[model samples]
Target: MPNGRDLGQDRGGDGTAASMIVTTKPPPANSPGKQKTVLLVDDQAFVRQIMWKALSATHAYKVLQAADGMAAINLMRDGGIKLEHAAGTDLMEAAAGAKIDCIVSDINMEPMNGLEFVKTIRVGMASVHRGTPVIMLTAHADKHFLSTAFALDVSGFLVKPVSGTVLVEKIERAIATPVALKSASDYATLIVPDVDTPDLYASVDAENEQSKTVRATDMAEQFSQQRPRFVAISELKVGDRLSEDLLTTEGVLVVPKGTRIAPALISALKDLSEIVKLMDRVSVVNV
Candidate 1:
């Protein structure tokens, strides 16, 4: 049986070995025999073009463009791009078995957003579409959005106005790393616990009614010790560690938890504050 590389080989018209013109065309630059595919989804034409051009310049990807999440989903379900001449055969089979390696999609779009699109593929789509790495592109940095994206098992998140080099780096990292899968139900449980669930306060509150007063006193002390201090954004100095993830009002992560402050980071935060005030204060661990 002919393998993927052996397909479309030059043959002899005369049906004789002597008449055969044996030649092998070189593979596309920077790729072996097959190029890894990337589905670029965005509602805007210019954004898609920019991503397409950037990936194309690397010569390591076969870029596919989609205007919306629905279109992108259809393309994924059908597998590889169908050629005009290959009729009556599955594109996946005809292509010698190639599938998309990564997906980069904009967060906001009409009909379906990026989060919805990812959920559909991960939960509702065929097994072939499941577990595929997805990188979300967005301008919003709201914590709620970040938490939702993380809960959905999105591979990576890139803030918008990203450069080509940064995009490529994110793509590479996403492809190389494997993310643990989680169901939407599991995510919901973690992000929003049931108010009626007894276990919600079990750790803090005593099970017996007799210990309620002691429990309250102990809880107050612990809370004071554990609670993070709110410091003025300007008062923040280098080397201070964040007690929790610093986020914009829109919920975008500014700096993640446990990050040691540096001069460059401080400067960036200052610049970011000019656009959006990071609440009037930031929470940091006392050093």
Candidate 2:
């Protein structure tokens, strides 16, 4: 879900208009030690090189580079790219049959920016690329851009001058997440990187009706207010199921009203006094 209204264009980059440019996710279970490749797109050669090395070193994952949106999309849609080896091997070919596991694009570009790039892959055009998770890299992490990016279904976000540690964390979360093409995790660990944590909740039944809405602002207010207490958010398999288990010291129990909520995000609902009061106000349940 992308909110176009707040996707303000970036002012840097030596080229034209095209380019533009989350949470506690659990450490995906033992991760098969299978590191997926990531595509990094940005105009600056230095940025691309640095990011590629940093991500590769930090995650033991392969990295691809693109100068802008079109290149990134092309590399992603194309079958796959070959990295050198003693046998002159093809990593993506023998492995997953794709060059990239996910995309990390700068939101602002010359003509077709990151947002548009994501739309290109996720939209009606390509079957193989339709579900690739897209992460955003930016220097302008203003309130609007942050909220707007996620609205468009952006998987991850990082401010400019990111550290290797943070970049690895963000990339892992995105690649491990599901897209139209596939789901990222098979274990509960992927959903909540740090286990045994609690997040707060407030009622928002009115917005649940728009579960499929890709528009950013559509759920901005509610999502923003809840993030403070939302210690973590895992992707739920089903949507519109509100059933949840309140994390209390007294052995946990399930609340059956989750039909309207996404199971992955249910852990975000904590039972703090204020959170309980908020849920009560909205009549979402105080579980």
Candidate 3:
């Protein structure tokens, strides 16, 4: 119920007042045994604290907290600040420079909402985590909200007051699922409308029964519209056409849409994927 400064009474384990920024150092960067890092973004300190406690309990994740979407973006851009234990034990020698594996964010927040943050990541081009999985947490589960969230490439959605166990499971699933398997249309289908709608075609036997038919030809025409198929660089073939623009994290355009894939281009894309985290899956249309 409380938003922002109104929840100042809440304090973390370090006796620090819950403010706009509250972060704990995770394992050091590049540690062979480092845990996966998850950015938990929410305006309410108490809610962040609850999720943090749940995540930390498992010792499986290094949790980072941000008050809102803007704060989360700033943290991502700046890498992350390292905080030492009260006894002067440095958990991180430098800033936690590890890439955020996933994000669990609340839909309602000030300055920039959760959906705005995701859109920024997708189009920002300069962001290394542009393709990172995002799990949205919302108090409202209306169809409009679900549709809008999926359009922005959200990986999963959880209503408020979510249990700790369920939150962890969702994070695991989000991270495990490849970017190629995430589809806006497929996710949107999860939101079923209240009105009773008949299947594509069915026989009606009501008092005022009126049977309607859908033309298979029209459906075939719609399906004929070439759709972009996402494939990993290793899976790319010579005849595939670029269905989406490909850009590096530095905002450099590597390949424009509509370019036909070639053997040389496939080799170059493979090299680029190895050099940066940006290009795991490329959208292409088969010739």
Candidate 4:
């Protein structure tokens, strides 16, 4: 994979090729209705063109194109898509002025992969960029890639060779979905922590004081009467009631408390154990 600097050279000096492909004409000022904007990033110009045409055909979107992850970030930071004649401006100022509804990006590109770009936007960029919905386009559907995408809070995922119609539907869905902005600490908890994980408890403790208070109150209320007994996860049996919610290391809720153990639930928990170890011990109330 070529780095951003190398791809910049490949696209004619200084990365002007990607910038030039963006529509130079600004959307009509004071137009009756504003069109939702989408940023499309792919290394291949042809792919970008196809997506641009497909999205534009809806007459519902104003499209922007980027050749790679680096170019995408630059465009996003610069505010609205740069026109051939427009004056340069800061991204924060532009983002404040105009909102971008969605981003559609390919996973593989030189200099900055889609994953890196998404991470930058989600956790490394300004608040304006952090919560924008993203739909990842990729040919690969392996668990590793999918898990990574989900961990970073990607709004949607589409396998490649998708039709323009499908693409448009995905874009709309992504736009309509609520954005759950995540912090770096949240990401770490979900992606890295496991059983024997003192790290998980530390993260929970480190959350904002208000959040800590709320969680403490909730836990206390739920476990007040029937305190849970910790047992090895492998020893769980049917008819046992969960004492608290089971969350993956990523903090995704797996099973809510009070759920009676069942074979299917056990099977699902076993699968989760392979990836997250949920927790070393199962907390259950005697039934």
Candidate 5:
């Protein structure tokens, strides 16, 4: 089990948070090619060790452990690190090239907290693994915390004292589910072209519920009419907003209309251009 401090309790009737019971069991087996790559991030060494031991019990997974979010980013972005087995043996020297299937991370930590890490990967410029599923582990389940996690588009959330079995189950579910594709309605404008990914667009009603935080002025501005200017993707800047739906030659929706440009998104578009044919220029609002 993953350990954590209960925020609302002093179960011992003393001055300290209650301790958590740690447990471990062998992970379920899977087909040879079904073995997944998992990244576990936590500030505590003991938590990382227990979780790693639980996951590494079988050949069902190739696990990587990091003490904090920064370290986790390094492991995913840079690679070239030595992966060690539970028996103090070198499991693989080429772990740097491995693709991570899912990530389990704690919310609280120093240098880079889980929330910051999630935002960086999901929206940051150098994020190659932006679409990777993430399962957040936290001691607090407050409303604000949950809303932030939802906005970041995390795959799953778990409270502390989570069992290895449940963690494994969540990981499997997250990996099996494709990342939710953003609908044109999710933004201020609808520039949908020909989307062929799937029919699994998120419900507009559900999105509106989560979007309660949008300011009244912002809502008005979205409905406001503005002229559009065609700008080359290479010249797209951080503050520019899309005025039309950005699509690939195959009808895949990339960046939606009215979405603000970011450095990371620009880089991602450039890289995507090599594989798929994106329009030479995008239509942006003429602010």
Candidate 6:
């Protein structure tokens, strides 16, 4: 501990406010390179409990949770939920406290909203947290709120009702983006949707040629690709006239019998669940 700042410094005592208790623990096993602490700020107790449960199910994170901006700021300022660093641990003295790897906050709250919270933290953060990333979790999708949030320089945005999987993916992306930017030149691994992926079919060939009664299994059995490989699928639903515009647009994924998706893909799948359901409803309607 640097200046021996106690996390429990009484707030109502003398002209100063104290922070909360340490609900979350730091990563138990530090393997040289590991993610640092994360702050979860939300007003709703139920929501916070759910978030913590999901987070705890994974890696150990030193969490300093706050119900509102004031509480959050107190924890942010007083180093951590406890007495800064635990002595000889690699954790540095609570200057700004642990390197705040990321911040997840709700948008609609009293006094200050998510946007206001972000601006405040960046403005008053200890040197370590000044550049910390913030992911705005909000229920508002209207253009007005969206515009306001973007102006605040939010690192990422997760709509309300974001699942644990999606939240984690957003966190990983925001954290990695900075490192990726440093590398400069960018490259995307293109995925040619393989029709062989079970339950997916390619109605048109790569040459935009359509075949009557195309079978998905056949398309997957034989896919031709030159580059890294991105599967091209035909958009043939039961009854709708197979439209050529599908070729002009993007493609689909042809999953194998049982393809276990990576965490990132799982996040995508969950996020697109609504779209998937809609497609399913249409699929049920025989053309």
The CA lDDT of each predicted structure is: 0.56, 0.45, 0.57, 0.60, 0.57, 0.45
Clashing residue pairs found in predicted model 1 = 141-251, 141-252, 142-250, 142-251, 142-252, 143-251
lDDT of 4: 0.60
Model 5 is weakest, by summed lDDT over 10 consecutive residues, at 189-198
Top-scoring candidate (TM-score): 4
TM-score of each: 0.53, 0.50, 0.54, 0.56, 0.52, 0.49
Assess candidate 5 and give its lDDT: 0.57
Best by lDDT: 4
Candidate 6 Cα outliers beyond 4 Å, as residue runs: 1-18, 25-32, 83-95, 124-128, 141-143, 179-287
Question: Could you give the candidate ranking by lDDT, starting with the highest?
Answer: 4, 3, 5, 1, 6, 2
Residue-level lDDT of model 6, residues 182-275, one tens digit each, is 1101011111122123122322234323322254344333332211122222222222321121111123322222122232222322333322
Model 2 agreement with the true structure over 1-287: per-residue lDDT tens digits: 12111121223365442222200111245645666667677766656656765654444665555667775555445544444422333233322355467778876664556655665665434333566667777653222233233324566566677677777776676666564232222111111111112222212234443542443343443444442222122323344323233232332222322223432123223212211222231113212
* Candidate 5 ranges with C-alpha deviation above 4 Å: 1-31, 86-96, 124-127, 141-143, 181-287
Report the number of clashing residue pairs per model. 6, 48, 0, 6, 3, 14
> Model 1, 1-287: lDDT tens per residue?
21112111122264211111111222354565565677777776667666766776666766665666766675555544442111222222222145668888877765566766776767746333566788877764323354455445667766667679878887887777665565544333333212122111111112344454564565445445765777987878776766666766755554555555654345434434324457567777654
**Which ranges in model 2 have alpha carbons more than 4 Å from their true place?**
1-32, 78-99, 179-287
| Candidate 4 lDDT score at position 150 | 54
- In candidate 5, how many Å is residue 149 off? 0.6
Which residue runs of candidate 3 sit more than 4 Å off their true CA positions? 1-33, 85-88, 92-96, 141-143, 181-287
lDDT of 3 by residue, 194-255 (tens): 21221211122342232112433443344368777898767878778767656555444456
**Cα error, candidate 3, residue 96 (Å):** 8.2
Q: Model 6 scores what on Cα lDDT?
A: 0.45
